[model samples]
Target: MKTLYRYISLELVKTATTAFFLFLFVILINRASQIAETILGQGVSFLDFFSILLKMLPAFFGIVIPIALIISITMVFLSMESNNEITALKSCGVSIKQISVPVIILGVVASAISFYSTMYLAPKSNVEVKRDIERLVKKKLTMSITPKNFSSNFPGIIFYVEKIFPQKGIIEDFMVSIQKKDKLITIFGKEGNLRTENDTVFLDILNGSAQILNWKKPKDFQFLTFKNYTVELFKFSSEERFNARKYQTLSQLLKEKNVESQTEILKRLCLSLSPLIVGILIFSIAVSLPRGAFGTGISLTLLTIVIYYVLYTFSKRLAFGLKLPEIALLPDILFGALSGLLYYLSIKEKLKIHTGARW
Candidate 1:
C-alpha cells in the first residue's frame, strides 16, 4: 500500500510539473512577442522589457497554475487506469478513497499558494509595475525631443528645428505654432532649448519671432520676435489613489468592509477554494475509469477538465453579477459534492450490491 501510494504521488507530481512548464513557456512566448514590438518602437533594450515581464509573473502564475494542476492530475490518473494499475490495486483490496489521500493533501497546498499570490504578491507587483512604467514614460519624454522631426507635444502646437546642440543646450531654425478660437500664432527662432526647474519644464527660444492670424480681421497678421521666450511643458497626470479592488490583499478581502466590497472579497476567497474541489473531482473521475485503452481514459479525463472549468467560470460570473455573498465557495461545494456522489457510485459498483443483495 505504501509503495502504491508513493508511486501514484510521484506520477501526479511529474505530470503537474510537466504541465506547468509547458503552459508557462507558451505564456512567456506570447508576452515576448508583445514586448518585442514595444521595445523596438521605444528604442529600449530587451533586458528592460524582460525585467518588466518577470515582475508580472506572480499574477500570471496565480491563474495558470490552478488550471495546469487540474489538467495534469486528470491526465495522470487516466494514464494509470489505462495501464490496468488501478484494476490491480482494486483486486488487492485497496479502495479508491484510500488512493485519493495524497491528491487531497496536494490540493490543500495548491489552494494556500493561490490565495497568497492573488492577495499579496499580485497586488504588490501591480503597484510597483505601474510606477516603473510611469517613470520610464517621463524619462523617454525628456530624452526624445530633438530637432529634424516635427513634434506635436501639445496638440495644436507644433515645433520644428533645423539644428540642435543638445550638450550645449541650443537649437537653431526653430518654429512654434499655437492655434486657438479664430486665431493662429506662429513663432520662429534662430536658437531654442529646453529648461527644467523646481519640477516645472520650460521650452526657451532665443531670438524667436511670433505671428498671429485673426479670422475676424481680414488683414490682421500680428507678428512679434523676442530675445528669449519660454513655454510651460505639457504636464503628465498624477497617479490616482489605489482602489479597494486594485491593491487589496486576500486578508483584507476576508475582512469584508462594506456591502459591495464584501461580495468581491467573498468571490476572491472562493477562487482560492477551487483547487481543493478540483482535486477531489479528479479522484472521483480517476476511480471511475475502467480497465481500458489509453484513448478511452484520456478522452474521459479531457471531458472532466472541460466540465470543471465551465462550472468554475459560470460560478465566478454569478458571484460577480448577482451580489452573491460568500459565493466563491459555491463552485467548490458543487464540484466537491459531485465528487462525493461519484465516489459513492464507485463504491457501489465495486461491492456489486443492488437494492436486493444476496447474503
Candidate 2:
C-alpha cells in the first residue's frame, strides 16, 4: 500500500506541476502586453519589468493552483485507467476508496497551499502591485495623460491633453473638468507639468482659466484666470491611508464589522478550502478504462470545473454584491456532498462513473 500510494502521489504531483506551469505560461503571455504598456513610457528598465513580474506572481498563483489541480488529477487518473493501472490495483484487492487515499492526501496538501496564497500572499501582492503602478504614474505624471483621451487619474476629476511629452512630464492644450456636488468646474490651461515635494503629487498648470457652472441656475456662473494653478493629485507617505476590500489582510478583515469585511472574509476562506473540495469532487469521476468519450474523465473534469466555477461565481456575487453573505459556503458544501455521493454510487455500480443520464 505504501508503494502504491507513493507511485500515485508522485504521478499526481508531477502532472499537477506540469499543468500549473502551462497555465502560468499562458496567463503570463496574455498579461505581458499590459505590463509592457504600463511601463512603456515610464523610464523603466528591463530589470524593473522583471521585478514587476515577480511582484505580480503571488496574485496569479492564488487563482491558478486550484484550476491546475483539477486538470492534473483528471489527466493522471484517466491516463492510469487507460494504461490498465487501476485495473491492476483492483485485481490486487484494492477497493476504489483505498486507491483514492493518495489523491485525498494530495488534496489536503493542495488545500494548505491554496490557503496560504489566498489568505496572505495574494492580498499582499495585490497591494504591492497597486503601489508599484501608482509609483510609476507618479514618476512621470504625464505618462498617464494621453492626448485625445480623457484621464481620470485624479479622484472625481477627468482631464484631456491635446499633446503630451511623457519623458519631460509636460502637457499642452490641457483641460480638466470636475463635478463638485451640483456644480461643474472646468479648467483650461495653455501648459501643465507635475511637481513633487515631500512625496506629494501636485499638478501645476500655467495660464489656466476656470469656469464654475451651477446646474440649478443657468445664469449663476463664475469665471477666473490664473498665471499658475496648483492641484494636489496625491500624497504618498507613511501617513497616507490605503484601504480597499481586496487590499486587506485576513487580520484586518476580521477586525472590521461591515458588509465588505464579511463578504471578503467568507469569500477568501471558502476559496482557501476550494482545492480540497474541488479535488475530491473531480477525483470521484475517475473509473476503469473509459467507454467512448463520455467516460474518458478529462471531459468530465472540464465539465466539473465549469460547473464549479459557475456556482463559485454565483456564490461570490450573492455574498459580495447582493448582501447575502450566508450562501458563500453553499457551493463548497454542495459539491462536497455531491462528490461523496457519486463516489459511493461508482463503487456500487463498478466502472460506471459517468452519471450524465441521471443528471
Candidate 3:
C-alpha cells in the first residue's frame, strides 16, 4: 500500500507539473501578443513592457494551475488503470476512497492558493498595470501630438498639432480654440512647441493669428506676428469607472452586501473553481480509454479546456447582464460536478467488465 501510494502520488505530481507548464506557455504567448502592439507603437520601453508582462503571469498561472492539476490527475490515473496498476491495487484490497483522499488534499491546497491570489495579489497587480498604462500614455501623449492632427478635446479648448520631434522639442503648425464667457476665441500659429518643467506643460506658439467672436459684439480679430506664444496646460485625468472585472478586489466583490456585487463575486468564484472542474472532467475521460489512446487523451483534454473557457466567458457576460443571483454560477458548477460523477461511473463500468469476465 505504501509503495502504491508513493507511485500514484509521484505520477500525479509529474502529470500536474507538465500540464501546468503547458498551460502557462500557451497563456503567456497569447497575452504577450495582445500587448505587443501597444508597447511598440506607444514607445514604451522594452524593460517596462517586460516588467508588466512578468507581473501579469502570476494571475495567469493562478488560473491555469488548477485546470492543469485536474487534467494531470486524470491522465495519471488513466495511464495506471490502462496498464493494470489500478487493477493490481484493487486485487490487493485497496478501495476507491483510499485513492481519493490524496486528490482531495491536492484540491484543497489548490483552492487555498486560488483564494489568496485572486483575493489580494491580483487586485494589487491590476492597479499597478493601470498605473503603468497611465505613465506610458502621459509619456507618449506629449510626443504623440503632431502637426495637422486633432490631439484631444478638452472642456473648452481644442488643440491641433503640426509636427513634433523629441530631441529638438519642436512643434509646428499649431492651433488652439478656447471659449470664455460665451466668447469664442480661435488662435492659429505658424509654429508651436511643447515643454514640461515639473508638473506643468506649456504649449508655445510663434507668429500666430487670433480671432475672437462674441455673441453681443462685432467680431474681433487680431493677427500677431510674434517671437513666441506660451499657454500653461493642464493634463486630463482619467476618471473612468472601473468594471467588476477590471480592477475589483475579491473581498470587495464578496463582502459588498449587494445583489449585483454578489453576482460578480460568484462569477469570480467560478473562475477560481474552473481548474478543478475542468481537470476532473479531463482526467475521467482520459482514464476510461485504453493505453493506445494517449494521444486522444491529450487532444480531448485540450479541446475540453478550450470549450470550458468559452463557456466561462459567455456565462460571465450573461451573469453580469442579467444581474443574476450568486447561484447563477450553478451551471458551471454542475458541469464540473458531472465530470467527477461521470468519472466515478466509468470506474464502475470498468469494474463490472472485470468481474463479469470469464477469461
Best by lDDT: 2
- TM-score for all models, in order of appearance: 0.70, 0.88, 0.74
Full-model lDDT, candidate 1: 0.68
**Count of backbone collisions within predicted model 1:** 0
Model 2, poorest ten-residue lDDT window?
A: 350-359
What does candidate 2's lDDT look like per residue over 50-145, in tens digits?
777778888877668888887778887877776677778778889888888887788888878888888789889888877877777667676566
lDDT tens digits, residue span 4-66, model 3: 667777787888888888988888788889887545544567898888787787666557777
> Stretches of candidate 1 above 4 Å error?
142-240, 252-256, 293-317, 347-359
Worst 10 residues of 3 by lDDT: 350-359
Clashing pairs in 2: none
**Candidate lDDT (C-alpha), each:** 0.68, 0.78, 0.67
Lowest-sum lDDT 10-residue window in model 1: 350-359
lDDT of 1 by residue, 41-65 (tens): 4545557677777876776666666
**By TM-score: ranked, best first:** 2, 3, 1
Candidate 1 residue pairs in clash (backbone atoms < 3 Å):
none
User: Which one is best on TM-score?
Assistant: 2
Error of 1 at 243 (Å): 2.1
